[model samples]
Target chain A: MEKPQFDLQQAISRSIQDLYEQGTITNSDRHELQAHLEDSAEGLITTGLSEEEAFLIAQKRLGRPELLNEEYAKVNHNLRTDKTWALLLAGFAAISTFIALISYSGSIYYYLLERFGLSNYTWPVVAFLCLQSTLFLFIALKKREVSNFLRDQVEMNPLRSIVFSFTLLALVKGMQIAVLRYLPKSFSYPASTIYGFQGDKLIEFATYVSLFCLFVSLLSIFFSLRSPTKGTWRAAFEKPSIAFLMLFGIGTACFAASTRSLSGLLPVPMHFTLFGLVYLMGAALISYYNENSKLHLFFFGIFGFCAELGVGVVADIDRAQRGIGQIYTPFFILSLIVGLMAGWYMGNMLRGKDAIPSR
Target chain B: MKEISKELMASSLAPIILLILRRQESYGYEIIQEIERLSGKKLAVAEGTLYPILKKMEAKEWIAATWKTGSTGKERRYYALTQKGHIELDSQYEQWNFLHDLINTLWKSPNLTYNRL
Candidate 1:
């Protein structure tokens, strides 16, 4: 008896069904595979084989369906476990946040009571901190499993990571501003008993701190964009744009200068001179880092040190007169904007051909 | 007598399957027998190979399958071509024809001269 011809379509249909049932291939993947199989079958038939023969031959060529299913299972497993890791990290972060809040409150309360006649409110502030810590710890421990499971689901979408990081920055900044507002005026500058320290100076200090924090946040954003597949040292090399470093350096200088001046009895003219020097030094550092020469790093170090010295001098000048003033000026604004733009440009340049969108 | 590579076979299976299903809805055993008869026993796909492909295609919505009672009262899965499968068949047929024409032109060139001549 002649051997009956095999139906290639029947084989392909069965394989797809098996894969889907096994959770090896997604619905869309099954469709794509079917389309590919159809083309392969046609090619076999055109090569002088009968339809039935072509179908059989095509099936053999497609390789072991079980092996493909195994590969799919491995990928799915990795996705599921990675989700667990993300959840674990989020839990740790929440606990850390609670701890940071309690520490912040304690420091603020102590400073307020010691500097002003605000000892009556210390217990209330301490109670509030304790309550916050208790609530955070309860939530962290009780919902650990649920949080991990939910994190697993959320981590599948990349955009969620960006939103989570932004939310963290917002929370940190909010807490910092709140702490600045509630602090006693005398704690700001004790030596300036001749002239009372206003809340405006505290606000100014908060603004400088916020700007510095914003610069660091941008660096974090860049790092998030360029994560390596694995390993700690390899990960650090995936730095953001050079512009980020420059902006951060200037922001740090401004913050340091303003804070020191607020505490110190600095002369107004000397403080202004120091501020001008900070700009000049920051500009030099930016120029040095931007250059593509062998001496670029050396120049960067020299200029960065100069910038630090300039900020230190300005703070000293402010301290000499027991005065506090604005650290941000038109030059600071221009440097920040220019640095951000340069960083973005450099980042895009580094991304190269792959960065171009398909459409 | 030489066997084809697995990659080539895998790539060609889809069109062959679609073409066969276009003829009529058929069960696995019958389809296997038909293929063997048509190929003159040149290609013999193991049961392990054929079933997975069938399941995969069915999952893709390119074909639909139903379990029906065979003449022996045994249950057998029958599969039929879907509308998407038909459209895919047309597109693949066009691509195959283009490739065939290009290969024929390249291989059967009349302007070639032999070294002996």
Candidate 2:
């Protein structure tokens, strides 16, 4: 007689959630509205109306969810702006945390592997890529759930997500350092000095850092499965990027500054890890953001991904081509024209709701 | 019964709500039902529009709400008029009466010409 039935309660709760997403109502407002509906339905039931009839009438009086959202949105003009800042912050935190873990962790792992007389990195790379693909698959399959969760975190508390991510990255980062004293070293990590890295050490450091960042990112997204976070390497692991030029600008800076600190890093070649990262990141962004996908975007994604992988391979051909545009330049800037159509298909497949709209 | 325009309902809701709260503390459902009964079911205020307005009036300190356990052991938010609300009701009453009288006068004498500044 007092509490509404579960079905009725759930319906009202959805309406309340819609209002919440609009940023207009608090939990107490939700309670007040729910109480009103329950009371109305209870009274109607007492008057010989069926339970469903009573629920419908109560819902009608409460107003439609769309209209309610609009009315609620009237008060919070900052709602969308706040959400954008939160998204960018979370994205930045995830990307940086991955970079840091990579800078240091691989060297630590390589030492452990060599001590055991195991020289293969093939298993780890395969395992890492598979885990990454699973994550991309999860985003596709759980698209509805993840998007809702994303909205809840981004809307409620953006900064908390950043703090939450840092904690996880820190945990993974901590694991590598704790093992450092026990492992045999083929290379020295500057840890503090930027000049500690050179030649083979730099290649090793950059390679592992790139590889580990990709691995951690996959792990991070996987953990993000249960989490609100994503995964990390570097002694320069100590510190930690943009839209278009901004991404390039930061990538160039990291390429130059971390050059020495990165000396002698990963067991797996750098190209493999970077290829995985580009595919996953591009896929994640495309699938998550694009609402109504045109099939052309799918083909475009494949083209773009291939070109991106091609560019990295082209650059690895230019380890001697180490500076800013130098990597992309020697690789033939044609790769850029070529990559525009690649990688985004996996994104479209992961779009979840409307994967491809057939005209 | 005549269907009241939402504009009139919106303007009149505050004074009516202030009066209802003055008589006794009541929750949203009861206050709305009371308004419907008083107006012979001619008015139907939306819960959507009503709550936000309640929030504004609550902010103005013309009303205060407290949670109480209703008969069925469920919590209900009951609202009461405050000192400022009595003043607001009086103000609204005067404003409405003046407008009411002016309209009555105009309707009674539709052809009168007046000076313009």
Candidate 3:
């Protein structure tokens, strides 16, 4: 007797897959049905029927596809509206950009520039932030819907998502630089005085500008966290520990550079060394906690700043008594200790009751 | 054999499925075969139609499904009635018996008369 090879299962699988692709049934239900269809086909094959005949009989017995799909839809809710919130996001971006372009040429730009003593360059920065705040307000109003849309509607490949995020960050940074470069001659007082043109008014002006930049950066990061694609933003930063470390490192480097330029103390090399040390500490903390919560990052930033202010007051006193040249050693050591303690505490609090194992 | 009315069959489907599962745990294919065998070919449940009923019952927590290897060395999904399902089956049985008795009594009633004129 010649035996027949069956392609019945393949045909059954293809039909089931068609239903799956059409969103008529979910993966689990499809598998169940496929198995049932195969079993029925096999049972008929065992009764001396050819593979083709058995497959046809099995499929016919399964009944109509439309009826099956209707029933599956009731249970699975497989079909859903294909609306993307990206459209809303894109519209906001386009409108904001158009408004900024118009404002750059119109009276509003000149009004802001004259009223705040802002140059043509700096006024755009303010305008840009205003536009960003409008978008943030929109996001806040529709956060839940936006979040759902992001999860369900947005199908992004990893590479595309990464490229989009990096481009967004670079664009923001470029705008900041453009604003900084276009400042008027009066805005140059901070840099000149910090490098020893030596006027109290110049120092105050520089301090105010620096303070404004610091505030803007903090606000930028805070708003980025609230974005619907926060996961992508978080991933770009690597881990929370590194983000905290990098922020602290950059802040320290800036402080060190400005102070070095101000008082001619502790040359450029030492500032680099200090940054290197903070970065290493950040890398070490990465080994401790691979993941960080937003709350943990928030507390770490707050505590790091508080520690700096506390230590800075003491360092200032020491500088008055012992001279600026002698203050770097103790100040650097104290800040490092304070940052480490804060980092450790925040990481522990997030993990909840799993304190560092006692030696 | 007369084909069962879709309306009557639809109404009776859940109770019939529950009764089959009551005897033993079974998968979709097995349950369908058992129904056909028990009815002596009078009742035929379309394979596509049974899944929706199973899904509904599972959602209501009247049944639970598990995957196990069948005799052919392939995995098959089996379904068994839950405690709630058993209670429901008992209730359905009582309701069906009452309806059956009522219909029988009405058919045999002395007052039941029809004028051909």
Poorest 10 consecutive residues by lDDT, candidate 3 chain A? A78-87
- Clash pairs (backbone) in predicted model 3: none
lDDT for each residue of candidate 3 in A1-359, tens digit (9 for 90 to 100)? 88756567678887776565455565577788899888899899999998899889888889888888887878876333222234344334434543433323223333344555554354456456555555554454444344433333323333344345446645654554465456543433233233322333223234433543544343443343234234232333345555565574455444433433333334645553553355334433432454543344443345444645667567777887876544454455455555455555555454434443211
Per-residue error for A175 in candidate 1, Å, reads 18
- State the lDDT of candidate 2 residue by residue for A172-262, as single tens digits: 6676566555544453244421322232343344354554455434543443333221111111111111143234223432333243332
Q: Rank by TM-score, highest first.
A: 2, 3, 1
Best TM-score among the predictions, by candidate number: 2
What would the per-residue lDDT of candidate 2 be over residues B31-98, giving only the tens digit for each residue? Answer: 98898899889877887667777877887999998999988799988899999999999999999999
CA error at residue B37 for candidate 3, angstroms: 1.4
TM-score of each: 0.30, 0.55, 0.42
lDDT of 3 at A28: 70
Candidate 3 residue-wise lDDT, B1-117, digit = tens? 458887897789999899899888999999999988988877788887898889899999889999999887888889899999999999989999999987887778858655421
Best prediction by lDDT: 3
Candidate DockQ values, in order, are: 0.05, 0.48, 0.55
TM-score: the better of candidates 1 and 2: 2
**lDDT (Cα, tens digit) per residue for candidate 1, span A296-322:** 323323343466556545755676567
